[model samples]
Target: MLDRKTFAEININNYIHNINFIKNKTKTEVIPVLKADAYGHGATQLAKVVENIGIKLIAVAFLGEGINIKKNGVNIETLVFNYATPKSIKENIDGYIYTIGSLEQLTELINFFGKNIKKIKFHLNINTGMNRMGIDIYNLDKIISLIKEYNINIHGAYSHFATADNLDDFIKEQYNNFISAIKYIEDSNINIPVKHICNSAASLFFPEYSLDYVRPGIATYGMQPSDIKIEKELKPVLTWKSTVARVGLLKKGESVSYGRTYFAKETIPTATIPVGYADGYFRQLSNKGYVLIQGKRCNIIGRVCMDQFVVETTQLNNVKLGEEVILIGKQKDNIISAENLASLAGTINYDITSKITKRVPRIYIEEE
Candidate 1:
């Protein structure tokens, strides 16, 4: 066993299960997004697992991540969705598919490839309504002309949905706009092979727009994108656990942790957990977050330190050193889920998992 007070238990079985579940739901090809190190579940490891299940296409945020996946021996079609700087572009984007949205990116690729380019493929990102990335739909004429002008080997075309998880009216508007863009491509007779737009929530809720491919991120990790309801059983795949470093008796009126933010009204029991903001446990959870100690919920006390935090255990008897502390996972009849922590930290569930720093070791678990 690795000697560490904090570690993440990654359920490999559930990870595969979530992938199969997505494939079943879409009834089409599924491109699992492994950006942010598979949302901090270890991207390379997850890529191997994904490839084992016959998934050919994988998506990452940038070129470095795609290269890392390839370097780690994941021989599959990897797509880089985010923009790349002019300096970052190289002659050899081998074993990778790149996305180009703006004219600048297209020009950069054209300049790099020049006349005699071989087998490099790219996707055209159409900005339907996200307004974050992708070419503006209104500028489709220029985008098409540029693709043909440079004789770019376009493999796919896609757009990201702005509000697929919520706002039904916006979903309809964005879908229509995306369809209009695709119609333009068809009318122009541009035969792009792959076309996708639905994200995790979209794939779950909107089967009609699954298109040629569906990219699922958070749902691939078995977590709902938002509090919005989706009728599917996605097993929780991550369990953040730590050990009680020390147990102590607190005197009446004695404060705990930094800033003396928490004080005892009377003599109380407390346990120090060896996890804090440095480990991606948000400091905002100070005096607000709760953890499971001996199968019961305990309130966090005082300001969460950079490396340690204290939890009030006066409600429990015989709280001892080395007792299990569930930071984000089920413990007996109780649980502290990523969604719970995200709500407390005023962020999304993806932030909760993706921000888990590399300092903490991930222990992969696969049960029979």
Candidate 2:
């Protein structure tokens, strides 16, 4: 048994099931995006699971993440979605793919690599509508020109959908724009080996846009994009658990935690858990969130501290120290999913899970 007081149990079998389910549903290859350490689910461990499943590609948000995973032995085709620093661009990128969103970035790489540099694979990021990264659709001429001048290999081109989860019109517009970008690349006689755009939501809802590959981020972790009903089934893989540390009696008129945010209406029994915002438990969920203790939902009753929070266990009988507390997972018939926490925190499931700090150990449950 693990010695940690608070830990997240990661079910690797469920992860494999989700990926295989996705492949079966879409009939398209998947490039698991491990950005933000697989959204705080530990990217390196998940990467190994993905590798063992024979996935050819893995994507990360930045070069450093890709480099770290590579150094840790994730040697499959890793793609860095963000550009690297000029000094470190050539280091640790032997077989890695990089994203080039602008002509200037493309030019920078060409100037640094020079004409005699080895062929480095890169993907063109077309700005369909997100407007965060990617070259403007109108700048295809410049993109084509850069492709001609550089000796880099064009692996693929991709665009992100800003509203693929909800807005149908906007998603279609982005898809059309991506199609136009692809047409321009083809007209320029450029050979892009793989073309992709579908994220988790898009792949599940709009399979038409699942071009050559799909990069599933949150859905790969068994989460839906929104609260809407999903046709495909995906099982959650993470279960955050903590042990009760202390128990106390809160008398009426006495408050709990900082600022006296929670005042007991009457004498009540309370329990403390060794987890707080510092452990990625959101402070916003101070009063709104509830945890499952002894298969009963215990309401959090205080301002969430950096390392501790109190929960009202008055409704439970004989609550004791070292009992299992389910923070974000199913407890008997009830569940406290990331979606549930995110809803209370006024954020998405991605933020809920990714914000979980590394102080809490992640216990991998690998079932053969």
Candidate 3:
């Protein structure tokens, strides 16, 4: 008996199902990424739901996120993928894992924790090809030296691919770089605890990239790089819905909404919904979006303003005030997937979930 609002409904069971799908896919282990607040589905709630589902590690993008989850009282090994401040690193080491990408950063960790550090877990990130984080491949020896000099526990050896999510020549080069770095590390006998490089796309489609454990982000929340076929069912955890605040009839040649972006050539009916870009519905969807209503798909009739938008429903009958509008989930006869929204905005699915504004209320639901 959870009372969900009209803005966002989180299907927790679907989220859990998606995680179990990935977990079973690996005969080995799975590290689910709960970063970006569980892809903006509320990290604390998601963590609690999946805590007992055999996830050995939970990862976040920043120090604050890790801390936030810690505050939630879930006791899984938390990893902050991005670099943290000295203060934040100490906090991460206090109860979670932090990433070590460079000797300079390693020195910062040592200075912050002092010799009091003991059995602190961290990943050694290799720049491989992304050149975004991690030590460069050429600095392998330096990184190894720092690993011991600082008494830092090597939890994992990780890297990021420049194009793992897309089909490109660069992926091959990045793969070579990743393999070379791993070989180099093994040759040095460092033997870091875990080895991983797969993002959601690579984990799902590129089996070759799955190493010790996959660091999957989007797919854990039922989203992949783009729309790709998967044998395992991935359930989308979040669904957006808002009530129709008002209903109206527009005569022929009547323009709807703020910018007059849509005009009706024939008399039609329109409904105003109290959701827009301010709620992370994406203003780009204005005059260009469709929502499922009464088991039928309806078009947006005007520009998506900050707090509201209009939908044309003349073709459909029996529409009324206070009816539910499906914005990001399957309705009776339609579906608006994260991939579907991302395609319209020329963005990634990750951005689509992360962009959801906090103003909207999130309600959690599980299988009855």
Q: For residues 119-194, write the lDDT of model 3, one tens digit per residue.
A: 5777778887787888877777887776656665777778887776665678778777888888887787777768
Scored by lDDT, model 2 comes in at 0.87
Residue ranges of candidate 3 with Cα displaced over 4 Å: 1-5, 111-114, 117-119, 227-232
Candidate 1 lDDT score at position 171: 79
Candidate 1, residue 194: how far the Cα is off, in Å = 0.8
Relative to the unseen true structure, what is the Cα RMSD of model 2?
1.5
Return whichever of 1 and 3 wins on TM-score.
1
Compare candidates 1 and 3 on lDDT and give the better one: 1
Q: Could you list the CA RMSD of all candidates, in the order they appear?
A: 1.5, 1.5, 2.3
Q: Per-prediction count of colliding residue pairs?
A: 0, 0, 1
Query: Which order, best to worst by lDDT?
Result: 2, 1, 3
Best by TM-score: 2
Task: Indicate which candidate wins on lDDT.
Answer: 2
lDDT of each: 0.86, 0.87, 0.78
In TM-score terms, candidate 1 sits at 0.96
